[model samples]
Target: MKLKLYADRMSQPVRAVIIFCKKNGIDFEEIRVDIAKRQNLTPEYAEINPMKQLPAIVDGRFKLFESHAILVYLASSFPGVADHWYPADVFKRSKIHSVLDWHHSNLRRGPTTIVRNTVLAPVLGRPLNPEAAAEGEKFLSASLSKIESVWLKGNGRFLLGGNQPSIADLSLVCDIMQLELLGETERNRLLGPYKEVQQWIENTRNATNPHFDEVHKILMKAKEKLQNPRMKGATNEGGGSDMKRTLHSRI
Candidate 1:
């Protein structure tokens, strides 16, 4: 069965699947959803993903949501392609899974919230409260510190017990890419103090992931567009406007 990915091209979760597929040489067709237009709330997308989230997939009769779930499904489905990506060893596999869980609760939400509140909202001509931005930065800083501590305790080439890329790396890399794409200054600020984290990010960027360069280019372009007043209205496609709306709606 041909795999169908429902996602926004510029979304980090979507990019994660793209990078995962590229690295494993798995071919999948992409169905782009413009989140800025609130396309995710439409009944059509709602049927595929009740959560109305991007990076969901349909594989024949099976459908899945959440990037980490998609990664595990893809890895297990295409056996012998990259064993190290999702090792068979029980302990190692558990470790990778643990990090993936931590990612969703801790690292992932913090910086993403910060980026949306501080950068994307202003670009969309929405009000950006400094107090909320400060809160986001605080959360992001705490998450980064946790990541630094974990890296310091481990072997450091990849997350868990591998010298090569693993599911842990893929999960972390996608979120870090989102943080970096917020802007150069914010990127440097978040990554500068964590040398190991910085190195790990660099390694993933240089790895054999086919969509790595493409993802980076898209993010960079998004950042540039967010910074330009003239391109403000035009930059709301993909996850930009939705993210902004979510951020403000929360406040």
Candidate 2:
């Protein structure tokens, strides 16, 4: 069965899933959804994902959403590669699941909100409110401290009880990459306080993942485009004027 993934190139969760597929040698097709254009919100996309979120998938006739769920599904679907990435032991499996759940509720939201407010919004020619940016920074910094304490408590290079990478590492890597793309100033501010977290981020980035280069290239382009003022408004769909209005109104 051919797998089809609906994703935004800049979305960290999407990249995380893509990296998993690449590392496991899973064959799939990517269908880009331009969130800046509100493409995900359109009825056509809503039919596939009612929440209008990126990184949804269709494996043959079966449809799925949520990056973590997709990761578990992919691992179980290909058991040959499961032992290391998604262990079979009950306790080990539970540990992985716990971290993933925490990722969804905590780690994932902090850096993402900060990057969107401080980096993506301004690059898209949308004015960033100073107060919101400061709040995002505060939230993200606190989250990083917790992540360092929880995951980096041991001297292990990988998360959980393993020498090799697992679903926990993959999920965390995706979230960490968002902070890395936030320019030097913001990236340092977010990552500097947590020494262990910084080292883990580097380890994950250097690890072997089939989609590493492809995902990295996309992120690099996004960072570059966002930093260039002259190109911001012209590059985005509808010049991002409508998105700016929508985001600001929500704030």
Candidate 3:
């Protein structure tokens, strides 16, 4: 049997995996597990992935979860993928490892929290969580600052001073893309200070063109919904069906 990928395009991590597979010419069946519909919460899906997250995979009898782990496994297990993605060099690969590890709490948490509170909560029939939003902003600011001062400080086309894109680049950039859901003022507040980070976003896009753009179409479409006044009003409602309806269509 071919590899099975349980994913949803609405998710950034899922998009990273899909983009990687497409970019590397890896053949696998793509399975959509819609989170907005709570499909992943089903009992059957739990058997496939106990954690019940999007972007799980079953390769033969082997099962893997977590986007970073999947990326490394694909890079290492596949025969012809580029070395820069999961480098063979001890130091370079170690740097990639370090970045990925740092990502879960720092880079990943920031946007997830912000988006969930600012946009997702309202759409889910819940009020915006101000405390959580403030916390997310604090962490997000720090993460971006580190990316500018530490990660991108190296003179390379991508992160870790490499000339080619790595999984880390795709992962963090996708996380940063969440800012698109914010209004212009808030988006600028979050992303404007990081000039190098912005440049890196473009470079990663250039490196992973067409595929990157293709995978992110869902997000691009959702960004448009944020501009609509009805959507904003729905979020303000404590538990509005319109908000759920909008999220279901877009998310």
Candidate 4:
């Protein structure tokens, strides 16, 4: 049987996994798990991923959840994957591991909270939380600073001074892609000051391009809908069906 990746592109980790597979020519069926409809919470999904999360995988009978672990598994298990992604060198690999682990608490925290409050909440039929957004900005700025000064300070374009992008680069960059849902001013306000982070993001995007933009098309569409006043009105009416229509089968 072919590999199966249970994913929803709206999810950052899912997008990352999809991009990695596409980039590496890994043949896997992308099983879309629409989170907006709570498809991930279904009993069948729970059996696949006991944690009930998007971006899980079923490689034959082997089932796995958590995006980071999934990425590592794919990089090592799949042939033709480039060494730059995970690297066979023990110390370099350990550094990549450090970044991925830090990503969970630091890098992941900011974008998830901020995007949900500013744009995603309304789409999910939930109310916006400005207070949370405000708090998230602090974490966001600090995390960006860490990435700029520590991660990107190296000689290479990606993390740890490597010319090629690593799994850490893919994961963190995909995490920040959610910020595309925000308006330009808010996005620039958060990312503009950090020149290194901006350039690094661009490098990662360029390196992964076509596929990078392809996977993020859902976010870009959602961003446009969030901007168009008519779309906004439609999204608010009729039990928010327009909003669902915009996101479903795409994000």
Candidate 5:
């Protein structure tokens, strides 16, 4: 049986999986799970992924969640996929593993917290938390400094001192990309000093190509909507459907 991917493109990890599948030409069914609609909370999706996360997979009788694990599984299971993505070299693979493990607590925290508080909370009728967003920016700034000074220090164009991109590169870049949803001032404040990191993001996008653009189109669309004048007074109670429509599906 072909692999089955349950995903919603609005999610960073889900976008990583989508881009990986397209880049490697992996055959899989794309099942859309709209998180804004509470679709992932349904009993049907629970059976596939007990965690009820956005990006889960079914390979025959086996079930798996967690984006990093899924990326590794795809690389190992598919013989046709390029080797550089999840290298067989012991040392290189070890570096990739290290990055993936470090990502959850460090790199992932900033955007998830910032975006949740700045964007989603207001949209969901929750009280806005400026303090939480401020804290997220602090973490985000530190994470970017590490990426610029340490992770990308090597001569290779990509992470892990490799000529080609790896899952580590994809995972972190997607997380950072979430910042694009912020308004210009806030986005610049958070990302402006990370020139190396910004360039790396472009490199990753170029490497992932048409697929990256396609998967990320929703984010761009949402960003545009946020800039609209009419959106100024939009409230969670009154504009819930509009927010749902803007964020729910691929276009």
Candidate 6:
């Protein structure tokens, strides 16, 4: 059996995983799980991911969930995946892990919460919460400042002085991309202050193009769809090439 990826590009982490697989030329099939439709909450998906998350995977009999875990698994398991993503060097891998862990509480929390409260609330059947958005902005601003002062200051195109983009780079950038749904003026206001962070976003995108752009088309589509009050719901489809082959991978 070929590896099966359960995902939806509307998700930030899901987009990261998809871009990683594409950049590494990993062969697999993507099974899209529509959150708006609540497909991920169904019993069938529960067996694959008890947490009922947007991105999960089945590699032969082994099942995995959580975007960062999946990225590390793929980077280490797949023959096609390059070592730079999750390097074998014990120290380097640990450093990368630190960034990934730091992301959830800092960078990921901000943008995800803000996006949900602002534009994404209506689609998710949620109410706008300016209180939560205000809090989220605090985290977002702090996260950006940390990135500028600590990570980007190293004079590398990617995070942690990596010449090439790593799994951490992809993961964090995808989270920031959620800002694309905001109006240009608002988006610029938030991101414009951090010149290095802005440039890092571009660098990561350049490192993994066409696929990065392809996977993120949903953001633009959603932005457009949200403008039309008449639309009830939008379609949630998988992104990436079919590119299937027989499954054989490590843990």
**Top-scoring candidate (lDDT):** 4
Local accuracy of candidate 2 as per-residue lDDT tens digits, 1-251: 67999987677788888888888788889897888678888999998889899889998788899889998999988646758788888888899999899887777777777776766675456777667767767777767777777766776887863677888888887777777557777677667778887777767767754467667676675565555546557765445554454333222
Candidate 2, residue 197: Cα displacement in angstroms equals 1.2
Instruction: Please write out the lDDT profile of model 1 over residues 1-251, one tens digit for every residue.
Output: 77999977667778878888877888888887778678888999999999998889999998899899999999999745578888788987888888888887777777667777777666567787677767767777777787767743577576653578887787777777777546677678777888877877777777754468875576776667555546545655535554455433322
Model 1 segments more than 4 A misplaced: 230-251
For residues 1-251, could you state the per-residue lDDT of candidate 6 as single tens digits?
A: 88899987878999999999998898889997777567788999999999988688899999999999999999989897777888999998998999999998899888878877886665454689999998989999999999988877686898999898889999999999988766567779899999999999999999999899999887776554545434423323222111000000000
Question: Which is the leading candidate under TM-score?
Answer: 4
TM-score of 3: 0.91
Clash count for each candidate, listed in order shown: 0, 0, 0, 1, 0, 0
Q: Candidate 3 on 1-251: residue-level lDDT in tens?
A: 88899998878899999999989989999988888778898998998899988789999999999999999999999878999899999998999989999998898889878988987675666899989998999999999999888888779978877789999999999888877777677788888888888889999988987999998887866665655645555555334355456466445
lDDT of 5 by residue, 1-251 (tens): 99999988889999999999999999999988888678888999999998988799999999999999999999999868898899999988999999888788788989878987886665556788999988988889888898878888988778766678999999999999888888688788788888888889999999999999999988876776665637634754246466645553422
Q: How large an RMSD does model 4 have?
A: 2.6
lDDT of 4 by residue, 68-132 (tens): 99999999999999999999999999999999999888888898899888776766667999999
Each model's lDDT comes to 0.74, 0.75, 0.84, 0.87, 0.84, 0.81
Q: What TM-score goes with each of the models?
A: 0.86, 0.86, 0.91, 0.93, 0.92, 0.88
The residue-level lDDT of candidate 4 at 49 comes to 93
- Cα error of candidate 1 at position 181, Å: 3.5
Better of 5 and 6 by TM-score: 5
**Candidate scoring better on TM-score of 1 and 5:** 5
Residue 137 CA error for candidate 3 (Å)?
Answer: 0.5
TM-score of 5: 0.92
**Pairs clashing within candidate 2:** none
